[model samples]
Target: MVCDMSSDIFSRQLDFSKFDLIYAGAQKNMGPAGTTLVVVKEDVLGKVSRKIPSMMDYKVHISKGSMFNTPPVFAVYTSMLTMQWLKDLGGIKAIEEENDKKARLIYSEIDLNPLFKGYAVKEDRSNMNATFTLENENLKETFDAMWKEAGINGLNGHRSVGGYRASMYNALSLDSVKVLVEVMSDLESKA
Candidate 1:
């Protein structure tokens, strides 16, 4: 099975061994947008009957040492740096714990606050992206100003969600989530 783990890759612990192949864009949990990381089970490659383009073929890429063509040097380097940083912080388990904590803090605030409501089903809510909306649509402007004043950035929800999205990546601290929770509480207080 080929798994695209673009949004959820490193933010939480996963059993990667179950998949025959896994790929993820670096922008979410790794680094920037120009690079992607792919992991393939060596034995699974060249087993497919269908032909793939040379660059798209995992075996060829592996044989070429992942330099079949000029690589995104800056993105790759930054991703390497991120990986080293994560390793320094005790690897996936530690990062997963922090991510879970951040998600919980923000989700708890969303659930308890009268002014906000979460988009996703409670059990299905993403640990990486907590999508929520203001209960009073008219308060959007007020809450927006509040979060901005609190120095929160990138809290805007996707166009489809039409609310707010608090992305709690592994690199994001629990303190940051607490600031958002505080902003939600402050907004509710004014309600």
Candidate 2:
């Protein structure tokens, strides 16, 4: 039931009320890959006849305020702290704006750079995952070394794509994108 409305196409296409539950791993756009966020409607449960495990029951968790079990204590706590940080930094809207800006900066560079092309189609490109690869095979090693030395980590594309991917999630700042762009520019200039 939890759809990622974060995608560009889902912006106007979503009707949030239709979903009984909405959940997202805070790792992608929210935080490091260890926290999950859940939002559920009060009356959606008990619609099915199948027996539910105690740990698998949403009603139980909801009834207990999501602390039904010990839970991933530190992970949840950190997620709460991150939420507070977001609030202090002018809330989700401001952070989303920053994320959009970073995506734009990275995507614009990808488009203009002849040596690289995005893995996803123009419309399907993910804001959180900027997947691209070197147009020239010879440049892979150089590009890899350059980016790593420039203090850019986790820019490697998924194995299926075998190229470079700059994941500009919410926690990643504009400064990181700038560093990546500089690396790209340097590589292109040398190429």
Candidate 3:
């Protein structure tokens, strides 16, 4: 199976042998945009019977060491530096621990704060995304202003979900999560 791993790339590690290919963009948890990461098993190549265009073919890119065309030099370098940063801090396992801590903090506030309700069930919760909505939608205006005044930005939910989303990516600090929880608690006080 070919998996688009952009969302979960630096948060955790996966078994590479199970997939024919995995592709990701280095923006969510790694670097700035303009770079794509592709991981494919060598055996999967040359098995396709159809014509594969040069630019679209992974084999061609592989043969060129991913430098076949104009590469996004800065994005690639930033990704490498971030990967090195993660490694120096103990790699995927370490980041997973951090992500879990952040997730737990936010989810606990979501559960404890009666005014807010989580978008997903406990077992279905994501370690990187804490999606929730205010039980009292009337407080949206006040709560929005509260978080913004607290120096938080991009806490809006996915456009389709239409509530609130806290993206605790790998680079996000645990203290940031604490700040968010504090904001939520403050909202509860005002309610």
Candidate 4:
């Protein structure tokens, strides 16, 4: 009964047999925004006590071959291209390894750096989004400037959670992760 929509999707593996319904917003690990890829065990629809709106119902979308309305063409096409690229790279199995390496590199710094603290519990840390915060809030402005100067962007955390979030998606390379780590380490040295 867990409706998990945490946005990892393609970046992390999940057992579909364990989930009656799983939804992923394409903007995260997939393509652009305005599209959501959903997988559901159809039987679960039968148990819904309330009526679902046509636009929001999975059954409708499935029945129409996902053409229930004017879909986001750009997002859908880009998502398809992303999937093809991933497949060519030996699919999820291969990308998962690269992702693990990137996560390890950054998390190692987050752990070793005295000026920073990881936001997620060590065991529950996400491979896609490694979140961490400053040990000294006073250093926020300085750290922000430092990372930006290092050519890092989109390093901000989710609006609901204020800190920093390093997104290690499928296409992000080990070298990119290294640059971020270097910036973090630089921050530590300067602190």
Candidate 5:
């Protein structure tokens, strides 16, 4: 199966072998959005009967060492640097552990805090993205101000799921999540 793992690519451990192709944009957990990374098994190519252009051909890209045309040099370099950083942090397995801890911290607070409610089922919750909502919709403005004042941003959820989404990526530290939890607790105190 082809998987678009843009948000959780290197943030968690994954069994890539199960996927025929895996692709991700560098913006979320790797680097900038200009670059995308794709992996495909060689055997899977040439199976399609349709004609594939050289630009869209995976085999062609691979044969050209992923330099078929001018690449986003800066984005590629940044992605390489981020990958190296992840490697130094002991690779995917280690980063997954750190990501899990961060998720658990915020999720625990969401469960404990009466003012907030998580959107996903416990068993299906994502380690990278914690979607939640304020129990009282009116309290959103107050909580937004609180988190903003505490130097927290990007907690806004998608329009379809209008609540909050706290992304605990590999690079996010535990202390950051603690700050969020403290903000949540403070909001609860004021409630």
Candidate 6:
């Protein structure tokens, strides 16, 4: 039940023993969007006596080696490539540091900017998706216009949660975060 919602997994300070399962979408920190990851203790598996359908059952998938009806072919292939890329880039430890640095810059900018405010509680806020909004509602139009002008795309927030969300996934570098901070700073000066 304990989810480390942070982007940089290495920055997680959670006590993993407390959780029954650990789940993460590969798209965010690991790989592309199509693949999902679940790691559960072997002892925790057979306790659910409910008759779960084949595809819906983790035990079945685990038994079948995840080749439950051919599986997501392209997603698995891409995921393999991403894992190799991670290995080549010095693995999880190195990537975690880079991700942390990127998140810090973006969060720092959002925190310091008078006009902008982050969405989540400080501790619960995701380092991957830095969700925030302009305090002056009138500035929404202006901010959208500015990001468009700067050739920045996908900074828009999810409709479920109004405002802006800069998703700095693993592939997104510190340089990209710096560029985004510069944009925020520029906008703040104008405001």
TM-scores, in order shown? 0.95, 0.87, 0.95, 0.91, 0.95, 0.86
Q: Which should have the higher TM-score, number 4 or number 6? A: 4
Rank the candidate models, highest lDDT first. 3, 5, 1, 4, 6, 2
Question: How many residue pairs clash in each candidate at the backbone level?
Answer: 0, 0, 0, 0, 0, 0
Mark the 10 consecutive residues where model 1 has the least summed lDDT. Answer: 7-16
Candidate 5 off by > 4 Å:
none
In the range 1-191, model 3's lDDT, one tens digit per residue, is 99998888979777778889989988888888998888999988878799989999989998998889999889889999999999998999999989989998999999999999999999999988899999999999999999999999999999998899999899999999999999999999988
Model 3 sits at a Cα RMSD from the real structure of: 1.2
Q: Residue 40 in model 2: shift from native, Å?
A: 1.3
**Model 4 stretches astray by more than 4 angstroms:** none
Model 6 C-alpha lDDT per residue in residues 1-191, reported as the tens digit of each score: 64644354433345667777777777665666777777777778877767878787778888988777775678778878887887788876777677778878988888889989999888987767889998999878888888777778998889999888898777887887887788888888888
Clashing pairs in 3: none
lDDT of 3: 0.92
Quality of model 4 by C-alpha lDDT: 0.85
Off by over 4 Å in 6: 1-19
lDDT (Cα, 0-100) at 75 in candidate 3: 89
Query: By the TM-score metric, which is better: model 1 or model 4?
Result: 1
- Cα deviation at 44, candidate 5, in Å, is 0.8
Task: Provide C-alpha RMSD values for all models, in order.
Answer: 1.3, 3.1, 1.2, 1.7, 1.2, 2.6
After TM-score superposition, the amount by which residue 82's alpha carbon in candidate 6 deviates from its true location, in angstroms, is 0.8
lDDT (tens digit, per residue) of candidate 2 on 63-159: 8988787777677777777777777878766776777788888898899989998888889877777899889999888988998899888887788
Candidate 4 lDDT over residue span 1-191, tens digit each: 44555467777555668988888788777787887888898888756789888888888888999898999888889999998988898877888888999999999999999988999999999888899999999999999998898888999999999999998877788998898888888878887
Model 5 lowest lDDT segment of ten = 7-16
